[model samples]
Target: MSASVANPNPNKSFEVVQPPSDSVTSLSFSPKGNYLVATSWDNQVRCWEITTTGATLSSVPKASTNHDQPVLCSTWKDDGTTVFSGGCDKQVKMWPLMAGGQATTVAMHDAPIKEVAWIPQMNVLVTGSWDKTLKYWDLRQSNPVHTQQLPERCYAMSVNHPLMVVGTTDRNFIVFNLQNPQTEFKRITSPLKYQTRCVAAFPDQQGFLVGSIEGRVGVHHLDDSQQSKNFTFKCHREGNEIYSVNALNFHPVHHTFVTSGSDGAFHFWDKDSKQRLKAMSRCSQPIPCSTFNNDGSIFAYSVCYDWSKGAENHNPATAKTYIFLHVPQESEVKAKPRAGTSGRK
Candidate 1:
């Protein structure tokens, strides 16, 4: 059964009222408000409104919709009033939140869609699928605006304005300059030695960070001149027992990031200083997905089985899923003075 533990600090974090009926696959915060959306393995997409009253935080279920198959990923439009979700059903559904409208299918793929993103700069929706292709949808049309073949099935993707990075099954990394969305800017293999679990672009758009199942992360820069700055670090391990780094999210303002892992722990780090900032207490179950709110004031994480052990180990009868809202203190997430250097890095 679930070995769930009590909240270590109730004031810092609180559990959401009602979470998904199944494992949560992804979590995203709206760009303009306190609304958070999650896509789950139960074929459902849910949105929650997070609010804080002095020292207490609470969540209210807002709106929800279902996919024909388990929803894999979701994204918010620039307006924050709409959401787009993709699933194993091979379809992308657009939901209008503020207007209280029904969701409608906007795009389709030949295979399960693993990741979805809304690019305000391009005014299009991008879907990466197991079909081994990256398709860009215009939303205005039934067909994709462009389809680019990938080296392998897309496993992870991260986008930051003019920069887009896609990590595929074979450790292939494809970087695109969205100013010219139709062409690839760079193609390289992952610096990590194992399959990529997650990826996040640097807020400055100069590089990207890739996490692997081997409990390691690689920091890569785009320019050859900055090649010396590239490095890798090991994390999410207990002695010789290592765990996959399942999610990586950069702070919107600080540029520092948080990494969640299969070991049921999460840590904040300053990439510029190459130093770990804070390591939170471990949960009873793995943290499958996590994200920072638009302002980085709140951190949302899912405590559930991540399926890293394959289908044989999942025990639905005993599995307990939870969504937590952690109000981060500025000192906990902000960067510190770099080593051997005075003042901020």
Candidate 2:
């Protein structure tokens, strides 16, 4: 049986929606919040419609053959009509929501493309790969507008407030000013001596949080002169290395943030207090990716496993997709005592 836990408030619940494919690698919600996009090892990107009715939960995935190799990451454009995906085939494919669903492939990297992000305001597409380099592509042009080399392979990245943050396997996080995307502006080293699996910038763009394999999460200030740990949390005290951290998002109107790890669990915390507010049970397999809806009222995750079906098998190829609605605790509406009862005792 799968174990589960709830917080004092215990407001949210999850419903598992099986995808047509088994090895989903990443999950993203459309800007409109009506659809969820999942990239898988099946070399396909699937779009699922989210709905609740008739006492049943289901996902309708719009299957489209877009990549030749396993899709590693996917993201939606600001307009929500266009979707972008990168794969092991070293190609970045763009899928337009209209027409015949034609995919435009862009050859930008030599090695597997690990992550992709689109800057809507500047109309720039940024991708990082196993090539140890980050490239910025102008969608209007056929070639990469700029490229910045790093010391190690980059796995995940987040862009906000015109600043780009890249997470590398070298246990370092690099920040670049998009105003000058051609140069590396700052770097933050991990305190636990472990590689950063994922990095996410706060919604306010004032700081960022990094998750490491050592099961430690570090929050850092963004200002150059004020670089320091704002808060730290030990996810696992026994020192179990967190294989990966996929989903990180802040609530739409609150200081709360959510995170999911390879441990098959999702955690919610107050960014300011650094206190874990809730922990929810996840899929039995490792969660490879996660993202919140634009409104933060809903969240989704993709659970993936390696393909080893033997005695020492830990990672499997099959994966599952899940989506949940975050239900906030209802505030108590206490009625004030009668004015005459104040000192009666």
Candidate 3:
């Protein structure tokens, strides 16, 4: 049994009151903090308002909307008043949160939309589809503002201001400088040998992290001169059993990042020091998605079947979905000193 499940600590961590009824595909915290939006295979997009009083935390359901099919991804607008969600229905819907109005279709794709992101800098919403194309939507217009093709089906994507990294099927990594939203900044093959599972850009926009199905993560720097600093590391493996790395999220404040895997474990790592900062006890089920709050004070993760093993392996009677919130100590997320330096030991 996982330590967290065995010993529930209300002060350090707590489970939200109500969670998605099905597999949670993605999680997005409001840029303004206090709100969290989750998209799930149940075809529902739900919002919750997070509140804290002393050591106790609670979540109040704010609003919920649905899609025609499983919602794959979601993102919040910079002002915190709107949310954009996409799904297997191949449609992207924009929700005006404050107004409590019905969602409207703002974008469409030829196939399932795998990822949806709000490019605040460009004031546009970008969607990546399994149709192997990326489309930027202006919202006001009837058509996409711009569309860029990918090498294969879109699997995962991460954006930080001007930097956007898209991981597609066939191990293709497409990088984009959002400043030049219409063109691809560069394209490269994934450093990891297995299929890409998730990708996250570094907080500084210097590079990005890519996780693969073989339980490994590749740290790649965009600049040629920094290529030598790039490397891949193994994680989430227990002896001979290797599981896919399902999610990667960078700390908004500390810059160190965390990786969740199909093995039901998550670990924080400092890329610069080449060391693991902290590793949480494994859960009973896979963690399909996770994210940090705006200020990085809390980490939210969903515990559920990832569907990687196919529908045959999923037992509805036995499966239970949960969303947990963990508050990390400063030492747990802050970067440690590099080798040869005396520090927090």
Q: Pick the candidate with the highest lDDT.
A: 1
Q: By TM-score, who's the top model here?
A: 1
lDDT of 2 at 43: 86
The TM-score between candidate 3 and the true structure equals: 0.95
Worst 10 residues of 3 by lDDT: 3-12
Q: Rank the candidates by TM-score, best first.
A: 1, 3, 2
Which parts of model 3 are misplaced by more than 4 Å?
1-12, 339-345
lDDT of 1 by residue, 62-144 (tens): 98999989999999999999999998999999999779999999989999999999999889999999999999999889989
Q: Tens digit of lDDT per residue, candidate 2, span 1-345?
A: 223431211323545455635566777878765677878877888777767564443566555656888998888888888889998999899888534488888646989999999888778888999999998888878889888898899877988857788988877888887787787888877655676777787767777888776667778887867665476777733244444455676665564677777666667776554567776655465555667777665666654453323336642332334444443341211122335667321
Give lDDT: candidate 3, residue 195: 96
Candidate 2: Cα lDDT at 264: 62
Per-residue error for 325 in candidate 2, Å, reads 6.1
Model 2 alpha-carbon miss at residue 103, Å: 0.9
Model 2 root-mean-square deviation: 6.4
What is the Cα root-mean-square deviation between model 3 and the actual structure? Answer: 2.5
Clash pairs (backbone) in predicted model 3: none
Per-residue lDDT tens digits for candidate 3, residues 1-345, read 545563322324578778889989998899897798999999999999989888767899999999999999999999999999999999999999867989999999999999999887788999999999999888789799888988999998989989999999999999999888788899989999999999999888889999999999999999999999999999999999999999998888888899989888888998988999988887778888999999998888888889999999998865778788888778789997767878653
